[model samples]
Target: ASAFYPAALGQTTLEQWHDLFASNAQAPFFLSQHLAPLLKANQGCIINIIDALAEQANPDFIPYSMAKTALRTLTTALAKALAPEVRVNGISPGAMLWPDGEHQLTEQQKQKILQQIPLQRVGTEWDIARTLYFLVEEAPYITGQDIAVDGGRSLNSVQLHAP
Candidate 1:
């Protein structure tokens, strides 16, 4: 369970920051900790879904970016903490789904985002699912690494923030 809200530093409330941390960082850590024994016993893997933007600090989404950075850290930390049995990895995705409701982008903004991707399109949920499938089934020697499935969006640093 993840929550994202577009808010700059001054615009963000403490509660919202905490909520982002809880959703993005704390939940994954505790859940992975609790599931580690079982995963180790079964020789299973842990795949965390991260955001491609986690690598860069977006002023428009300060807390969201921070929390996701923490998740990225936690993913690697857990990989070392649970090594030799349970392989831990992460998938950093970009622009898979358009924001709805209050965060919904205008048509122009959506087009702006599409232009940033080298593939020039948004990704389908199936893209993520297929990556997940690969990490679970095909990837055996891979661990403690994050795979970017962003259609090359991360290759560019331009960001679109709600106005």
Candidate 2:
């Protein structure tokens, strides 16, 4: 349930990400430090919320895609090793929640997002929630998989922006 900064490589991205690269990609290591504690508590499941960019690189987001792709890899690797004691998986949500008051969302912007989705509509948070619910409640046998809650958006290349 976290959001990243402007991924709109819409020309303003470089200015936004200059410092991130120079910054040591530090969070994963810190999180890695906590894995043992979570396992000990028997809360051995990790649900990674990856981004839309994990599957498709939008014209507006190259770095974001790169980062999320790395995260997707982690999701798989961790799941394999943590089996029996822990489960690690991911869910990639697309257009589930509008940025709302944090970001100025206009009808045109909403339309632009939908234009890139085959469903011709954005997803509601409930869509993502239900998908996660299945991964958690219904699928104990299903581990190490990533469920994409994108309203089938990732399937259509033309429906996504390419950089």
Candidate 3:
């Protein structure tokens, strides 16, 4: 499933927020639940593509953050609910794709974001894909985990007060 949804507060209505949550979070949970039998029989895995904002608050994108956080919670819940039959995990991506058109970032904004990432770069889609492959094919003993494929962006630390 894709994590495409509308963001922005105030401009986004309550109904829009609900729709975003339903599509981003609820759909995955229900789909997984509906496919539980098939997954259990085949020992399958569910990998959710959440957002890095799920782990942190983004004042500018409250709805999107909430939806992703819900998905993250659902991933852990399903992992336990599905148990040994099916593995459930999540990948939270950070700055993998540039926003198009009006949402595009300025060079300064882009540099600021990159500087926050310890790796000083954005991740590739392939990074997330490889992690998914590992969770499914190699991580037999692993479940109920959310891997951050974020090029260390999530580890960026803020100094509330400078040293």
Which is the leading candidate under TM-score?
Answer: 1
Per-residue lDDT of candidate 1, residues 50-139 (tens digit):
898798778998888988999999989988999899899999999988878887899999999898999988998999999999999999
Worst 10 residues of 3 by lDDT: 1-10
- Local accuracy of candidate 2 as per-residue lDDT tens digits, 41-156: 67556677777767875766666666677777877887776677777778888777677676869989989888878788778878878878888777777777888788878776
* lDDT agreement of model 3 with the native: 0.85
> What residue pairs clash in candidate 1, if any at all?
none
Tell me the lDDT of candidate 1.
0.90
Alpha carbon RMSD to native, model 3: 3.0
Per-prediction TM-score to the true structure, in the order listed: 0.92, 0.73, 0.90
Best by lDDT: 1
Q: Order candidates by lDDT, high to low.
A: 1, 3, 2
What global local distance difference test value does model 2 have? 0.69
lDDT of 1 at 148: 91
Candidate 3, number of clashes: 0
Alpha-carbon runs more than 4 Å astray in model 1 = 157-163
Please identify model 3 stretches exceeding 4 Å from their true place: 1-6, 157-163
Q: Any runs in candidate 2 off by more than 4 Å, and if so which?
A: 1-3, 7-29, 40-43, 101-105, 158-163
Clashing pairs in 2: 9-60
